[model samples]
Target: MRLSNKRKAPLYNFINTALIMFLVMGILAFFAEEMRFQLLGMEAYLFIAVPAMLIIIFYLNGRQIFEYDSDGEALHFRNRNIVPFMSTPLSDEFPKYKFVKFETFTFLFFKRLYITINSKSGNTILKYEISYLTWKELNDLKFSLNKVIKNNKEKVNDE
Candidate 1:
């Protein structure tokens, strides 16, 4: 089973908007100051660095995809961009993984989730931050994770 979850969060939107505004402001500041490298020594560096960093951040935030692949016995986390990558398996031994949900109180209520994988080596915890997931996606992820966990638990018991 392959479950595709799209996580959209206002926090990312906010950050993207803020970054864009900063880029614009930085550009204007660069030009308005007449490229005075001596007077604006540190600020001059912002022009080149901010755009480069923003491009990377945009690619990472915009093109992310997470997949739960049961048949392959793996959870794949990917970022669809120039750099394509997959998550490393927990370990050679089949590790036990479970999903946990918790709520955060901000201006509004937000629900968060994380995956805990237990292996012979150690335990690995992957937290799904509010910036990466919305409440709806979190619920869907929880449901899918619960199903996977139940099946694994049953298989363990049967063996």
Candidate 2:
């Protein structure tokens, strides 16, 4: 089935980093007015390095998806302006499907949703950092996945 949601604002993972960099640069710039070459050099480096790093990180991971599809065989996750990430052989013999929310206080990054598929082989399949999704999208994805699992279960029961 096809599932989608309205796109929301991009979630920035480098906010704290940007803020700290700005603060440090401001301080260094203030001190550099006294002709401290070392501090001036540090400020220059910080001014360039901080935004450059932020841009690189944003480009690498900031693309967020508003829709996904699972057609009983594979999972297709799509995002804006980037290649979609897909998973195949969507397992059905899982003991349970768990939804989890994880946050990293150190980096000020939060993930609003994660799906963990527990398998009989004592292994788990995990999909992480789905915070960009709206509630509707999340629900649709859950529903589609459960439907697949249910069908698989029924097929096994018939056999």
Candidate 3:
């Protein structure tokens, strides 16, 4: 099976554009004397605080593109942020027999996928940010990984 989120790029781009516009407006309000003191009788701190908080929230709820492929005796997983040039992509491909286990964890607003593989030295864990994947996609991913793990275990017992 192959799964990817290339279709969601436009949605993420829209969110990024809105956030940037908001930040620009916030900075403008900070400099405008009348808007800062007169409009809605709001505090100047609000303009600064709100935009900063929005940025933090956006960062925590990372917008990323995720791909998972399990075919031809191997599994491939790739994760990259939507923001270009900000961070490097995470990718891993290992044989089905090497797949040890898979787990997931949620921190704050984002979800993570952890894949563990047995190596000569020790167990190595790879992490990927999966916050942007929908529930259906997540279920598909979990099901695929679990199937591989089960097959690996059975193969070991047979041998």
C-alpha lDDT (0 to 100) for residue 13 of candidate 2: 28
Q: lDDT tens digits, residues 40-93, model 3?
A: 454765776798788778767753799999989888998887887867888889
The top-ranked prediction according to TM-score is 3
Comparison by TM-score, 2 against 3, better one:
3
Residue 30 lDDT, candidate 3, scale 0-100: 75
lDDT of each: 0.51, 0.49, 0.84
Q: Candidate 1, which segments miss by more than 4 Å at Cα?
A: 1-22, 25-65, 79-113, 128-130
Residue lDDT tens for model 2, 1-159: 776543333333245356557667755665674456554544565655665665565544434444565654555545442323422222222232221112212123433344445446654544444555555666676676667667656776899
* Alpha carbon deviation, residue 50, candidate 1 (Å): 15
Top-lDDT structure, candidate number: 3
Q: Model 2 reaches what TM-score against the true structure?
A: 0.41
For candidate 3, list the clashing residue pairs, or say none. Answer: none
TM-scores across all candidates?
Answer: 0.45, 0.41, 0.90
- Candidate 2 — what's its lDDT? 0.49
Ranking by lDDT: 3, 1, 2
For model 3, the local distance difference test gives 0.84
* Model 1 quality (TM-score): 0.45
